[model samples]
Target: MDALMAAFVAAALAQVGDRPAWLAAILADRYRAPGLVIAMAALALLGAGLLAAAAGAVLAPRLTPEAKQLFLALALLFHGGGALFPVKAPERLDRWRIGAAATSLAGLFILAFGDGVQFVVLALAARADLPWLAAAGATLGSLAVIVPAAVLGERGWTALPLVPMRRIIGALFVVAALWLGLDALRLI
Candidate 1:
């Protein structure tokens, strides 16, 4: 329980004004239906976190220390490598065919895949042996910030000052990725 709470607090603090905000800003810029977009994004994040948590819970008891270290090292390597080369910007949401819901889901999947927050939350959840609680906490923490940002983003680009925020968040993500990578490698 203490571990869960600590992981939750750490994950929550790490998420604020970073990846979630950036995701919200991107969705707002690309999509028309903010509410639907937010919902879809929330669902996608929830799904990913749940999946990660399940994996963590199932594997926790079996993993040797060396195996655990190796897994963490690999995760850090992949995440850090990804931070170095971001994906191309997603196409603007098509408002008619797929509508806002699908677009939101797609956007969420894309963003969550690249998000340091998601990785950190999953790693902590896995390490702490409380996948479900960690997943729930991470999902909630992500949405708590993202939904508001989407709402504000819908108002206008100026409503959130998204451009500068994006840059700041991007930089933070790189730093986090590097730190996590180094920590995993026992090089920090």
Candidate 2:
């Protein structure tokens, strides 16, 4: 479906080299259980993505076309700017009391609460009439980034030039935002 593909691509690209992916890597290493880490991460992503889609479904009907476009553009603009700056993720989480699955679930769910990928999913869903499909796509897209990190482990993560990748994606998002923003204003 159009909504599914759009959401999938947007969320997948938005999450590349992002905090959640890196955090998954950390968790996989710490737990020595990549499968468990991946499962927990998947569950978290699914929950977040569904919630975003639901919110978008509720909100989209209320917003005018221009408003929806503007909101999506703004969300993209904000996320792009943040990605370009590259904030350092929290160095540690207290995992002493939690088991591997619990730690991964809790950490990832909490970390992804308002993350760019989730926002991207929200924005995509907001634009799509089929919001549930968008949510499913977003969840899979998130796994596209997360599953690899869990399977490949630390060396694989280090091999990627994360900062450069983030900047590139950020630049792309900004360009998209500008175009969408302009169109929303009827200037394009």
Candidate 3:
């Protein structure tokens, strides 16, 4: 239980601190509807977290240590490669008209889909023992990171230095992925 809780906390913090906040801020600014955008983003994250928890509950026990290690390693490699060689940023939201709500939602969904932090949280939650607690913690932690970013974004982009923060979080993810991989391999 202790180990599971620790893993949950560690994973939650890592996910919360990662690049999603920066993306959320950018999205909020682009959409010019920080409140709605933030809420939708939070809903997407929450839904993903719930799915992860469900998966964890169903799959964690069946996974062998080797399989877990392999999964972690693959996840790390995939996510790290993505961060190291990021794709071009998406085009700005079309917020010029009032009928852009559907477009905005679609854009938010796409943004959340590309959010590595959301994926990390889901993966970690899927590995956690207390899936409910892990999911709740991750969901709340994500909101903690995102709400602030959205607020700051609404105020102004200059209100925060997101670039350095993103690098820091990315480094943390690399370290975490390596750590999980090592543990899964029984090398830790």
- For residues 1-188, could you state the per-residue lDDT of candidate 2 as single tens digits? 77799778777887888878888888898888999999998899889888988889888989999998998898889888888986586444654467898889988888777687777778778889788888889778888988897777767885888789888989998999999999999999
From the highest TM-score down, the ranking of the candidates is: 2, 3, 1
Q: Judged by lDDT against the true structure, how good is candidate 2?
A: 0.83
Model number with the top TM-score: 2
Screening candidate 1 with a backbone cut-off below 3 angstroms (N, C-alpha, C), the clashing residue pairs are: none
TM-score of each: 0.62, 0.93, 0.69
Candidate closest to the true structure, highest lDDT:
2
Cα lDDT of model 3 by residue, 52-93, tens digit: 667666767788757755665655555554554433444555
Model 2 alpha-carbon miss at residue 146, Å: 0.9
Q: Which 10 successive residues of model 3 have the least lDDT summed?
A: 2-11
**Local distance difference test, per candidate?**
0.61, 0.83, 0.59
Clash counts per candidate, in order, are 0, 0, 0
lDDT of 1 by residue, 89-127 (tens): 444444536656776787677666566655655565566
Better of 1 and 2 by TM-score: 2
